[model samples]
Target: MPKHSRHSAKKRRDPRRKTMDQITAENDSMTLKRSLTATQLLLMGVGTTVGAGVYVMTGTAAAEYAGPAVLLSFLIAAASCLFTAFCYGELASTFPVAGSSYSYAYIAMGERTAWNISWLMLLEYGISCTAVAAGLSGYLNSLLGIFHIHLPQWLTHTSLQPVPGSEGTALTAGWRLDLIGFLSVILVTALLARGVEESARFNSLIVALKIGVLFLFLIIGVGYITPANWVPFIPPAQANFHFGVAGIFRAASIIFFAYGGFEAVSTASSEARNPTRDIPIGIIGSLLICTVIYVAVAAVLLGIVPYAKLDVADPLAVATQIMGKPWLALLVNGGATIGLASVLLGLMYGQSRILLTTGRDGLIPSVFSEIHPRYRTPARGTFIMGGIIALMTATLPIDIISDLVSLGTALAFAMVCFTVIWQRNYAPETKRPFRVPLGGIRIRGFWIGVTPLLGIIFCLVMILPLLFNMVHALLGGNPVPVLLLVGYFLIGVLTYRFYGFHNSLMAPSRPHEQGTSSHPE
Candidate 1:
């Protein structure tokens, strides 16, 4: 082949292999304001981390899978998250960009990989935001019940629900919509449109309030521990993912959704006042804090009530009711309602930012990249993504999609870990303000660091059970989850081929194009 032809082919193959300098230049040019401090970032992580899973997943995981061993499940999930958190810290410091893992992937791997990671992140944050909103609606309804102000069932429930044991293959329809969930998304969207600083402030306040309520529950509920309830702590296996050692890992996968908040913090790297110092602090600090709180809450919750009876939407409220503390139950419900809203804020914020970055790259419409001149936020993109999530929350059943969220999160985390290893080997001279602890050994031509390797392994461990369950469901006549995943990937591929491939800023023919679109309306 001719040398010029070879050069053109190389450019076509890897057009978006951004160097560290390019990434830094892009960060310097970002319109997003850098008003967030380390403290607010940490609180935002906590606010997003300590929501639906702690308030809801714990009970169902305990009742159906881990039983009293659910506390151990929390530990396992935290451990898996810890290694990825370290990798995120390193990558965030190395490339403090708004796209988070997507940015890291573009710099390390290429644009195609980055686009897929961004797509998976969309699946992660989009569904997660909707799920959190749906959870908030349930808690909100419970809180209103305390005041004897009941909403009509049609207003409180979703219009579509997955059939019990259908694994998402069967759905039941009704004249219903979660108005509270829909409105909550709109409210959070408005706050995010106002600006990142205002949204972080609201999240910090909610985090503080929810932590206080949880600590109160711990203080009062500890004295009521019925030690007998913990007998046979690891329940015997009844079926796949049902009460055994397998169940413990299964429960870990289910609750992994709660640990996703730390990832959201990395998305704010471009907005952090001190990305090098503060991003790591926010990522690692929030994970450690939320883990301890999760374990403590799980212990107290199981102690106060039998795990068998804790599968309801409002598990903490159930425990409080069992303790005959209607007031505490009200408080817990109120805290959950408020806390899940913070999750919505952080997730929606992260999702919109990801869209902004992708749009700037020309993988999607440039309109999403438009920043509001006054608010300095992705207001237009925020409304578009929020509307989709709100519509989904109001209409669709989320139960079957919950595991899919965990799967997407694990994949994105694994890519982040791999990016650290890739950058370490390919761009060793790049200055890193934060490094994943534990030096690595090189095998053959590749250097594999212990932290990132373990991160990948742990993510795979978290993913295996979920995959097994998906296969199990498929074989048992429930193919919705697997089909949905495949369909989503196909959509991503078609999008890249039809739109992203032609319009990409990094295309060989458009090497010098700067993405300076007009401001969003």
Candidate 2:
């Protein structure tokens, strides 16, 4: 070979540049049991995707942003997620692995990008799990109220509550902690540590019950439609992202949290019986099903009660109360309580798997990679993440956590879309059981497909409002969210530089350590 060609080859062989074959070898070496079927995977996606959004976020979006037009917000958010879901389907099929976007980035971009994506997954899965747990606490409290059992406010509420006249611009600490939310995480973590198959079965049952509750609401609540409440479906502009056309977009961005879990199916690829085909089915099918259910339920919810009255913790329960049906309210709250627990299960499960994959790659501590000998699950990592989530759930308010989760989720999704385009351009010969539709023109030797391009654009749409709101909040004297995000980014960078950059399994010095046992050092 020519001298220049030899130099180029040597440079391209950097450890960070993990090839598709390397990723496939890693997948082949995974020990997580392959017991989940297409049906279970679909239910997992649905179980995670359908919660908090319908049970909690819908009310906030309606009352605060788009009013009755929050249904449009659901459609808009679903549209964006649908595109990204396609990108996820393609990537998951091509590279069925545990890390989901992180593993995909490792193959398509490099280790630095994979590390960043992994950090974002922490925000997406970990914090989102916390947010869901917080929402579940509200439902549980409401359900207990139906039985005339009232928990103490300090025990049921978040420690940080928004200031009354601060319009969510300020938070004040109080002697409060969501005990139910904290305990809920612990229980689900134990369930996940038990095994994936058992968790999937539990998730399936919860998904069915929630779906039935939503259908019940639709069937009965549709009859209570007050046409006047939806008079101005698109309420006039009161402020930026407050009750106008912009509000629809803003609400879409906020409620985008609702669609956060579909990609979680991709994280289950390592444990899938037939990942190539099943992962795609799970990702896309669940999104389509949940979108229809979301739109239908939103319409019924708004018709039964004016959007103005929906800014409460338990919106469906509030709606049932307005209709003078205590029985229905009890059932709705019951469904939400059980339903959000499944979301916790799915999110925590995905978070642990991401930690396992990242740890195996040496981006984080190896303890996270430790799989239980008997259960074949990442028990150690699950317990650790669950503890963090439980603490967050006990302290932070859901509104604050949800926005950060949505921002992280949107960015991760955009990276997933870009990975598809990158892989197609660089590794055209790679076999893909599923391909994102809408073939596109090659740009300077890079295949920029239409579907992935649209996915990227929609993802931006879903996050722009969030960015704007964060900026607005900063200007209005609330720098908490922005500071939190920046702090997280800096922490990620510092950790990568100090540890991951040197210890990565792909590092030249650690080449032989790529598939070591998942026991702690």
Candidate 3:
């Protein structure tokens, strides 16, 4: 290497050049205003958390497994979430950082763990944005169809296959690609680029609108509910593949995606005024509120129509259309369009922060850690993430994308629970504001391991049913589909090995405290 080139490399590697904390300093930087009260944060969580998953996935889950026993599926999912939420609450209260579990893992487990968590989160947030963007486009097209406005064909068609039963027959189908979905993704990226407060306020308004529409649905739709629809609540599955307990567990796995945005609350922790108190309130409060709404919506949906008649492949607009009220369908579609925008923004914010954290730790390129000179946000990383999602939404089929989102999130949650258990065993000194009580603290060594023991078991049990179903769904249908998913994880592993592993910030820090902010220490 030339002398100047060597000097440049030395400069790039200089630890004193700037720290992540320095990059995040309030001076001459756009500080994220600590304007979100617990109420706003809760609303933000709801805004991001409740979207296509409940409005669309409920029917699909009901059709595939659990039948009307789908209600139990949700309960099962929420219970698992409550346990994970306990884990998240403990971590968020202690660190109160932007990267959520990825950050928490970094501080507790070391660089390698942090890199994997961030890699998994990248899948969870970015690809999920693509899925949500596609969802928003579907709703928008339904709304526009009422006005006799149609989207162009070029935008709608992409290199993806429609789910087997979902492809309308050869004669009537106009086009396969979705242009509006791509546009919606771009629009959301634009909104995110503008700023966080704007995004939050926009989300708050949409949350109010969607919740109101849902309540109206409950009031009006619930009245039309007939007892006939509720019978055969646990219908038999095809091929004698009847999953009683297993079906509920599978439902729990799917519904888990519906509850994903609860972690978005933690992304704002660094900017929160009293992060320790507010972070937990934001997470727990949002879950409680959304869970109630989900149950109400499920009850009304199943009651109003037979589970067999529900369109698992179609979006929620069709469900309302079947209600024989086109205007209500319009309202539902509009609410969904607005509702999913908030989901995109919250998710985009999360993706950027994780990228920023990864860069700060030298796991990728340091440029990713760069905060916008004026916006004080991870502007570069945000743009890169949003652009990739926009392209994905423009091209990919919805369920294909959704599966990746669900798979990634499930893996991440499973790991998070494991990390919490690992912490209790190895790092007895770490501060935890809220701890899951395992009574008889001084009993035999086995007693000390019980809380973590149960937590790990809980995660594994929750994961098993879905793993079986997805594998079956993949094999029973096409092995190609399963290979594609494998491809995604393989890419993640390769990326980590060549880029993330060599560049990781963990080499200098103790594994147990790898990702903590150097400033705090």
Candidate 4:
């Protein structure tokens, strides 16, 4: 501990004295267990990325913008993610910590930047996890339907859709709760609370089943591909936004959320057996796996049904229905349910880790940092996150939750990648276990990291339109996301003002720092 004056002795032993150097030291005494392998980390990345977006959004994107050309949208999103992945790979390898982008920002920028990103991470992980869980509930309903089993209307669908659909599952009574979504959050929270290893094992098994189901659909659906669906692949231009070549980019931006699953994997750096090698492998490998599957699925889905017909809640299930395969459709629905559930597990786990980091850094209440003695996890914070997610699932629709996630992700990913460039200049001598390729080569009398530079550009391309649309939505009275963002921002700012600013480990006038009082009296 740093030396402190006698008058300042009442403060709890200040963590402000701890430095990045201290955390980076070998075999440090942090709470998280280091048991995750490359395979487990990779599976975690894959599990989160291949959820409802591919199962649901592919068709939506096709119906709205790209038509049969949404396959290229997946490829575009994947390329942007690859560059962002490259940035993540280098940082996670170098920092090797639990907070993911928040940790990287702290090392490269300062405390305030880390604080904002960590707060946004709540949207990326916790809120989105809830949305995905809600989606899982819908698919679970679809799966149960295969057995002629159906829940009451209010039990499954929300009242967000004013005119309820024919399934009689959607309710006209205002503000109906998604009972299954609420239940899934609690169940997944229990799994997370048990232990990370146990949760990871379940994730691995379930992810395999999900992927196998996707491949089965691909193999079977290939024969049903009508070549006529390929004509007029890029839909004609529409008035409001991008169409033609621009439509593909717009679709890429929407589906870009699918590739963000790897960010959750990066947060597990503190738990990996060998973070240097494993982090990069986990991030890149899983992205490749998901990208191929997403592209193939998009092609097959468009081939089976017209783009206009693809705009349902469960696109894959709809495609299977068109193919006259009810049983296979049920299997696809089950796969989506399992896939979305695994995503919830990973997101919840990652969110708690980020919360714990902020707590340890004195950005939030330190109690959130405490790890469970027996479970070796952030037990308190994980459960707290669960309750919040559960509330969100019951109140909000899946689409609204998804929009928040995309905005948060683009902001976080862009800043994280930008941090790589900043770090190169700010701490040139800092030991890097892994450096992003194409960055080391000097250009115009400056050492620039090319990958991160392009990453920032790519992320911004996706972020700007979303930002404009969000502002437009707020102007049009869709206030949920704006209200949520402002509410969280105010809470974070107030926390910083009242608590985190003074309590921060990096604070200049810390308990330990020796300084004469200005009054001197």
Candidate 5:
């Protein structure tokens, strides 16, 4: 490392003094483990990425939007995800850092963009965890019901929905506080805080269980499909295309959540045996595996039940009930409960790492950068993130949380794509294990990275409807998910301007210059 001036050295070394440099260097103690193979990493990605969305959302989408055309919605969403994954594959290969998109943004775009990306990640990680927690509660209830144990509504329901297909307009809800959801979050947090290696291993096991359960669903559900259910593949259009289009776009955003944990693969780049090769493979390969699974599961789902009747919170279980195989519902629910645990663990792990990075950058409090010496993990950040996620799940509505997650995730991906382009122009000499091919010399005689540019455009297009819907909802209009993102981004700006900017590493000088903070090891 280059020798710093006396002032810079003091700032870099003193943990108590609270400069960004000190925090950054403190993280130098984190050693690489290289335990995960490409297969395990891919399985980790798939475990988190293929959760409640495919199992439940298929029915939800079929009921509201294209009916039989819900499969098309899955296709549209998959196309959008594929574009983003290419960008992720390239960046993960290059950075190989624990902070995922935030670290990439820092090196490529500068500190401000890094701050913003980290800020958005707070929501992406938190809300996604809470949403899965909610799903877990549903599955838990279903599992219990199989044993003839029906809990009171106050324990299971968040809000009431009108009785399905009933003209009576009567409404019912399960319960007020979901105990199973709350407990699952706490359990996953405990497992994650233990260590990265343990968490990855646990996630891998969960992924395997999910795959097995899905295969079971495919075999059993196939036998239950009636030829009559296939009559009108596309439900005949009603007079209102407004809800049709709106619902399709909304479902698209919802499904977007199913695609996000691939970035979590990048967050573990530092620990990969060969990050340059494994990170890209993990990101892209995981996405491909999950995408195929998602589409197949959605198809098999619609095949088992008429599309119109499929839109329950737990669609797969509902279908099993219709098949008069109550035991299968319990088994599927058990699988779903386990499946969502991996999602929460993966997402929370990714989010906390981002916060740890930002804290080290002096964009947040220095406390967040503190790693446990023995574990070499950011224990403080992990626990804090767990608390936030738990509180969020205990309070927020699942729909709002789901939408916010999609928006934040998309925003982070967009910045990463932009960062890739910016880095080629400004940091061409920087060493990278992977590089996006330059298509041409600079427009103004400067070299440009076209891959990131294309990635940005694709993400932007996919995010448009999400944005519109979110705004519409916020203004009491036809709201969609992207609006929640805008709201959170605004908060991020305020937070950065007031706190992160003032304390930022890019600032001209440090307040204390007397000592160096020791690295964690």
Candidate 6:
């Protein structure tokens, strides 16, 4: 090679010039304000998990798939989430970083893996906030009608959305926009831009209100559970994806979104006042709580109404009406709004944190990592993402884009489960305040930890159908959100090429701890 070119190549390979390597132990540049208690973290988890899935998914899953056995579907989904939650508990304690799975992946996998996870996480947050906002819009409008306040149909509906069951345009006649969903994202973005502490406090209160509303549903609706509804619990499967055992698995996969909040907890590890002790508590505790709520609500919802009649957007509200209680319906609608707001808050908060971590590692622009001088949050990135999401809500009918968030999140969970076992084998000496139980029992040749392995399997099981269906849609000429996802990933690649790759702050760092005890020095 020529002398100048050789020098340039040497500079590129210089250990000191490496960016992601520097992001290993702890970050030095971007600092997030730490002010959340364990309760706040738990609240954030519960708020995120208990949102649209319970309010919207329960009816649909029960109606279309699991029948009354939707309760079993909830159990199956929650169990799958618990295994990954154990892995998250350990990583949150081990790294105590803002990036969550991306941080753990950095330690266990490599810089490139971490960057990819971070990119996917950005999608997770953006799409989650978008979908939740859209769902919340419907409930919000319903609640508004209680006070005789109703927006025009065109302002409230999306444009040219094909109706799911039959030949239709998702609504009657004229071109329209889902303005309410768009405004919902704008409102959440504004709240998150302020700071984490404020957001957590608000999330906690919302969590409490929604939990109370759920309990009220159980308290009232349980008495009216007609014995007939629970009889054919696992209704026979009529078709491939409809009611049966296959339907239960399908329901579990669909309802997996109910557990998105627990993963969101790890993103707040940096902000947790006592991360090592509290993150585990938040992750596991919230899973347990949400599971109980889902099980009870599913049973009651199916009991109050036939499983066949439970496919509406607002299941809990529908249950109340069947029981001849419009007042209860109003309260349930109120809870749904609070539930969605908290979900959006958690998703957006996690999204910005992922961006901050990515930027800090020079995997993206450092401007995203720039914390507000006064608010102590990633204000610029939060608003940018918010604007991006708000624009999508207004212009793009995101019916398909929403599941992209769920897919990305499930992929991240699987990655975290992989990280735990990898760390157990690779860095056993590393300090972990919470470790996954029944671990390190190697099976056969290539397997080690059983807990995380189950998590990985289940995660893949959940993700595969979504992948297949998406590809199926693309092949059928509906190349919508898939194309958008491709574009988004292309943008990330360009960002990496233009800025992240060469500017990375990586330095040589030990992947495994060098302990005097282990070394016997």
Best by lDDT: 1
Overlapping backbone residue pairs in candidate 2 total 0
The Cα local distance difference test for each model comes to: 0.89, 0.86, 0.70, 0.79, 0.71, 0.78
Order of all candidates by lDDT, from best down to worst? 1, 2, 4, 6, 5, 3
* Candidate 1: residue 324 lDDT (0-100): 92
Instruction: Give the least accurate 10-residue stretch of model 5, judged by summed lDDT.
Output: 12-21
Local error of candidate 6 at residue 173 (angstroms): 12
How many Å off is the CA of 221 in candidate 3? 1.3
- Please state the error at residue 281 of candidate 1 in Å: 0.2
Write model 5 residue lDDT over 1-521, tens digit each, in one string: 12233335335332322222443344344563557778778877888788867777777767776676666677777766666677777777766666787777765545676777788778777778888888888887877877889988776655444455432224455446666677787788777777878888888888888889888888888887776776566665654222355455556666777788787888877667777898888888888888888878887788888877876888888788888887777778888888988888888877777777778767889777777877767787778778767766655566534556677777777787776766555545556666654453566534545666766665676577666655555565333344355566788888888988778655555535223532231
TM-score of structure candidate 5: 0.84
Top model number, TM-score: 1
Q: Once model 5 is optimally superposed onto the true structure by TM-score, how far is the C-alpha of residue 429 displaced, in angstroms?
A: 3.9
Compared with the true structure, model 6 gives a TM-score of: 0.88
Error of 6 at 72 (Å): 1.2
What TM-score do all the candidates reach, one by one? 0.95, 0.94, 0.85, 0.89, 0.84, 0.88
Model 1: clashing residue pairs? none
Comparing 2 and 5 by lDDT, which wins?
2
The CA lDDT at 47 in model 6 is 90
Candidate 4's displacement at residue 467, Å, is 2.2
Residues 249-320, candidate 6, lDDT per residue (tens digit)? Answer: 878888987787788889887788888899889999999999998898888888889888888888888789
lDDT of 2 at 302: 88
RMSD of candidate 1 to true structure, Å: 4.2
The order of the candidates by TM-score, greatest first, is 1, 2, 4, 6, 3, 5
